[model samples]
Target: MEQAFSGRRVLVVDDNADAAELVGEVMSLHGHDVVVAHGGKAALAAAATFLPDVVFLDIGMPDMDGYEVACALRRDPSFDTARIVALTAWGDLASRARAVACGFDGHLVKPAMLDSLINEAALAR
Candidate 1:
């Protein structure tokens, strides 16, 4: 797809490097500056420095789940303007509701379609 997010910054957090990189590449293709973090702690650390416009956070991780990370990010004033999107394999309504409760701005099921994902990213912008 053609780039639509030139100059934008996006953070991607996933334990699976391949999945994270795939999303990162897609964001990069859209001209966004993509930062990939392998876990919740790393993701938060990167957020402090990257100050991304949007964050794609995975629900499952070693140190912390996406819920904790989302709560933390929501509490941080630095990330107040950043859009937090839950990215997980769990696609059920319950999981999505949990993501919302945790302060995620949006929820994306794993293996998301490129168009829908890109659309959500654009909506965040």
Candidate 2:
């Protein structure tokens, strides 16, 4: 049987307010502690204090893209064990490859299924 996890610290980052809030709300409803960051900079700030167990990041922000944020987070020792998943509309092969190259643990396309989000969070270490 598969193991289960709950109450994880989850960070949802997206320049789109609705998207971020929606994901945050979903995670919260599923019993995870959720923080929504509207941009990459805010994401970094929130991560510093939130120290999330799992981060769902959007790739196309204007200020800083998810790839950059993922790189920055990967450099921080505190995030060494955190799961960073690219949550974006860019589902093309190249984008997925780029996400992997930038230290993302997983890649979920935009409008990802609710069950997928919960399952991903549960996989966080």
Which lDDT values do the candidates have, in the order given? 0.87, 0.93
Question: Best-fitting candidate, measured by lDDT?
Answer: 2
lDDT score for residue 83 of model 2? 99
With a 3 Å backbone cut-off (N, CA, C), the pairs that clash in candidate 1 are none
- Candidate 1 per-residue lDDT, tens place, 13-60, comes to 999999999999988888888999999999989999999988999998
Scored against the true structure, residue 19 in model 1 reaches a CA lDDT of 96
Which runs of model 2 end up more than 4 angstroms from their true locations?
Answer: 1-3
Q: TM-scores across all candidates?
A: 0.92, 0.95
Clash pairs, candidate 2, are none
Deviation (Å) of 13 in candidate 1: 0.4
Report lDDT (Cα) of residue 103, candidate 1.
Answer: 86
